[model samples]
Target: MAWTVPGLLAVVLVAALLTAMARGYALRRQLLDQPGERRSHAVATPRGGGIAIVVSQLLAYIGVGVLFPQAAATLAIFSAGLVMVAGIGWWDDHRPLPALPRLGVHVLAGLLLGALVWHWTGEASSAGFSVLLAIALINVWNFMDGIDGLAATQALLASVAYALLLPAPVAGLALILAAGVLGFLPFNFPKARIFMGDVGSGALGYLLAGLVALGLGTRSAPWTILLVPLAAFLVDAGLTLAGRVFRGERWMEAHTQHLYQRWVKSGCSHVMVTSGYALFGVAGIVLMHVFTWLPSPWSHLAALAWAAAAAGLWSVLLNKVHR
Candidate 1:
């Protein structure tokens, strides 16, 4: 609950150990992700390393709730939602499930999280918007998990931003989440020894959404301020989805058409692409904080302008690469 440095380090170490164990388990169980035309990696790698992150973060959340009973209900909602999302993702990782079933579970998790936000803020409108945002983040994170390290790294950046911008308990939660992902990153980045799989990615999306909702409910910052840190992911996933629909492509089909994917296909290494996106995330966070000083309406405009600039830069990179 205190989020002392030693306590956080301990959690990170435990997460790393758990992640290492999960990697062994995945190898023994043959839960490997094989390379494909759409995949970024060349060799088969163990998957589901995200289970460690999920487990560690959940444990931390429970610990926090126990220490701060006032937060118990909020943590309970988060834990429940995480279980539902991670459960379906775990199942899908080992045995592919129908899209409808997965989507249904996602919707359920969104509603639960939305309810949690509404409970805290006592605003029906906020709850409705949070529900929609949660679902979209879940799907977008899942869609962007095609490459090694991209999703996890993005989650790390966003969590760090949240930790910096938010207040006590929420900031502590964000830090714990960041450490968990940090522990998992070594097994995933540069060249993935294990993938986060759907389990990790989906849970992370939900977790980040929950953090944003918590910040908004507490008035730590405006909704747009919280959203700014996620611009890289939102822009890429949004633009790619729109492009797919416009081209009449099967939007749900696996493909390497994402900006990061395109960068890889154009001969950039996964590290380069991921780092580029990380910089985008960092920039967005910086801009969000800066805009907090402006008048309310201007702050909103500033956020939108920053996002548009990011989108335009991405478009230029995509075009240059393709050409």
Candidate 2:
């Protein structure tokens, strides 16, 4: 497949238009948006914008994969993983489902999609590592969803950035995903008109895990592509959970201890906070590849240690932010 700027642009445009239209419809319908304390923004914004993102990305992947059968199997697994996100996220959006039930869906979805992905691409060995990676990313995306447009914005930046970095199948699909979220950002940014809700955030999270896995395991571009840019989310989620455990608090329940959440609570602008995270994430990726020539082991222990330390430090650091 020839890499062309026009082709990528075309995919992005399609995604943006699709997401914008879906968000517009949600606005017109006055869907479920009950904003109050605990939310990033004060205004009531339309929700469920993730539905459009899921649809646009799925369609784009299918269209591309059909044209390039060699990539079809890999993409089919991606598309299936997305369906899991949509099915379960949409259900949660309509009515908050039990935590265990919702988690069961995520777990099953991750495992099933993981199996398909592993089988289709001979990623079986990678799957052993990817199962935990996939689940961690899904939670990272979910936990980072607290701020207005933060999760969606991160998805958009990471997708496009990584696409530019690795332009084959990963970049192609990422182009579409980025476009879809970019189209929705205007409505979801600092002063949001609509939110991505669980639909967009969850699906984006799942898709990201797939992209990173493909990029790292197959492309071997750099480990940083999968880690640093996402450090903000990973650190926050990992650290928050660690802190909770240390403090004898439940890890899964809703809370405002996330670094991003703490920043917002301290009277910082949401855009400023979100942008800070994005920059830090991009920095992490850059640093990863600065020495890309070095052969390295894919150390899960090291990754966890980094995440745990970062989270722990951030949890403590946040205490001094507004206090």
Candidate 3:
């Protein structure tokens, strides 16, 4: 898809309309939320704006698919799978869904995404790994949903940067999504006029997992290297959650224990921390591109080291901010 000026204009216009309507709908529906003891924002804000991301992606899929029917079913399955997660998440936002049911929905969506990717790719070695990766990614993304603009920012970066790292079908679908998140972030960042709610974050997590698996299917990029766009979030969330479980905390409960959350609590502004994360993502993706030409499997190790360093740095900065 060589994007001409008209194509770019179409994306921006569609995205802006989607964002404006989402903001209006969330506010009108009294879907706004307040800053809680566990929340990073200090003001009441509309929270269901992630619906705009869902809407934009669907429209783009239809527009793109009609031009390229080969991708129609693939986009359909991708949208259908992600929408289930978004639907459950939106319902929970309006009505507090019980924990068990939500988890069940997540599992079902994850399973469906895995099944569709496997069916489409017909790749054998990827089956179990896709399911496992999908679960890990969904949870990591959920965990990363701590600060304003963080999750959406990362999604935009992955979608944009994947152009070099991923193949066509996976890349096109992901870019469509990336554009939506990019359009949404302005309303989500800094002072936080609106939030992604669970609807945006959970669905985003599920979609990213599916796309990443699809991107790496036949590509020879080391598993660890490919994960670089998000390794910091994974490490922080995985370790923190596991530590809480070991300490007898109710792991199912939502709390602001994530390192970024703590950093904000320690007194960093949301802009500073979120900006740091965006820059870190850019660096990681750049590194991945730089190392792809290398011969050794150890290039992945460099990324892993960088990820660990980032996690440690953020933890230290957070504690210092706390003090």
lDDT scores of the candidates, listed in order: 0.88, 0.70, 0.76
Candidate 2: list runs displaced more than 4 Å: 1-4, 120-125, 164-169, 219-225, 297-316
Instruction: Answer with 2 or 3, whichever has the higher TM-score.
Output: 3
Summing lDDT over every window of 10 consecutive residues in candidate 2, give the lowest-scoring window.
291-300
Candidate 1: give its CA RMSD in angstroms. 1.2
lDDT of 1 at 34: 86
Which lDDT value does model 3 have at 25? 88
Number of clashes recorded per candidate: 0, 3, 0
lDDT of 3 by residue, 29-85 (tens): 988777799777787888877777877777787887888898788778777877888
After superposition on all C-alphas, the RMSD of every candidate to the true structure, in Å, is 1.2, 3.1, 2.2
Better of 1 and 3 by lDDT: 1
Greater lDDT among 1 and 2 belongs to: 1
lDDT string for model 2 (139-256, tens) is 6777778777789878877776667666565567667677767666776776776677777777888888777776655555645435655666777777678889999987877778
Q: Which runs of model 3 end up more than 4 angstroms from their true locations?
A: 2-5, 120-125, 218-220
The TM-scores, one per candidate, come to 0.97, 0.86, 0.91
Worst 10-residue lDDT window, candidate 3: 1-10
